[model samples]
Target chain A: MGQPAPAVLLPDMSAAGEVSLESLRGKVVYVDFWASWCGPCRISFPILEQLRNELGPEGFEVLAINVDEVEADARQFLADVTVSYPVVRDANGTTPLAFGVMGMPTGYLVDRTGVVRVIHQGFRKSDGEPLRASIVELLGE
Target chain B: MKTLTSLLMAVVLCGCETVQPWERGILAKEEMQWQTNVSEAQLRNQIYASKEASSGGAGASGGGCGCN
Candidate 1:
């Protein structure tokens, strides 16, 4: 059985208002939990960004949440790696806690119906291929 | 009576500090985390160094001992 994703409504660092996972129900949503200090998170961000850019028009969205307690640290990280997708700050670390994130750079792929199709923890370059394939397949559905 | 006692002992021995999947969310809470104890460690090291008249890796350039 597909599990429904936990409710997520967080402050957008780049925008003025909050962005909710509920608002992204019809799209294939990728909910990412990342921290600036996590080494693998640095490796995963650009690759996930590419996937989002390539598949975004096909009803896919990447909602990357920065779990740094200090929002400025996340901003500094963004300065080094610029991505097009909507990025939000979970300064209180509430969302990652809710998602049961044991490590940094955890990702949850939700289908269009808001069901969690997959959960990925940590990332490598080759991991993107399988992830992209899954995204494409989800888009086809 | 012996069999019943053995069964109870086996069950108690098997159940040592295993957190379930659903209960992991509580364990993942920020308050339940120990990563923030780095400062506590730093404080301990500083106190030890001060008492021993030794200063090393105290965020400054010093090759006092424990390999920089």
Candidate 2:
């Protein structure tokens, strides 16, 4: 899991432009692949937002990659559960293909050096503690 | 005959394709479910199980009275 993260360039759901993973190289990034239909994502989003807010000043970033086929579903989901992090839309499903994502709500933790250290699949309430610990360790590094 | 059967089997297997995780949105749609109406399907299963005097094979287990 130490490989460099695959380049991601997708339409920014939060703003008018695009967002690229290359621009966030120096920060510890959590690249989360999610969809509105994914049940676990509803639980994961708020926790991820909490993590981002808590660790953001320390250079931790959560870049959400939405893989919803219909952009309206994603917008509806965001309207219900809001987050301040930059959310990008991979409506064509290319990013998940490049990442070889096998399940919904998968996450890749990329260290400050852009190397993927963790590939997390499926999220639950109990996963938050360990995930935070891992991010903290990477930030320490 | 054996060789022809094996060839036919291979050809049949070639028609199957694995659905990738990201492409499963269509499958997750309400219209794609085998039983879109959950309560109706459950009731049908319950009645069938009651008639057969069997339970627990499909979904939730229930008594054979069909009351469940």
Candidate 3:
């Protein structure tokens, strides 16, 4: 909130695709930085999917940015996990570095203006209630 | 006689190989090699960012370009 939040334009699943934080303006966005091999990341994927489906129509978006080195691995992981949100493959993890991610499964709740309101780190399934509450608050705001 | 004593010592040492579940507490200590404390996390993150192509884990603040 001090300086402007870092801007990240990440690659989308489509061959010619690219998505940017700036493009997500006017909607509440949840940007999650994660890797395929991270255990906690695997654990939280389903919860994220639920959030996306449950709140998508309400202008909520979940962007799962995979930090895997290989695009195939990222794709395979998503295939196995079956997440409903957009899975951005950061093969080089450029977006993650721009966001200063120090931990796996770190999520940024950004409001409609592209301003990050809350940062959630290393969340567990048990954290579903509190995490949902934070997302709701941002959505309401 | 000396060979028998050496064999007895070997068995005693080998018997100590098993680690009980309760003893795992010591293995789980913050001071242990696998244990991560605040400072250690910082160092490990720095190392991980530099060495690994992928990023993100748990705990810590901010982001960096070390991995990219």
List the DockQ of the predictions in order: 0.05, 0.63, 0.02
**Candidate 3 lDDT score relative to the true structure:** 0.73
Clashing pairs in 3: A100-B62, A100-B63, A100-B64, A101-B63, A103-B56, A103-B57, A103-B58, A104-B56, A104-B57, A104-B58
Q: Write the per-residue lDDT of candidate 2 for residues A108-137, one digit (tens) a residue.
A: 999999999999999999999999999999
Best-to-worst ranking by lDDT: 2, 1, 3
**Model 1: CAPRI class:** incorrect
lDDT of 3 by residue, A70-90 (tens): 567667777788866777766
Best by lDDT: 2
Question: Which DockQ-derived CAPRI band holds candidate 3?
Answer: incorrect
RMSD of each: 10.1, 3.2, 19.3
How many clashing residue pairs, candidate 3?
10
Best by the DockQ measure: 2
Q: Quick one: best TM-score, which candidate?
A: 2
Q: What C-alpha lDDT does candidate 1 achieve relative to the native structure?
A: 0.81
Better of 1 and 3 by TM-score: 1
lDDT measured at residue A2 in model 3 versus the true structure, 0 to 100: 22
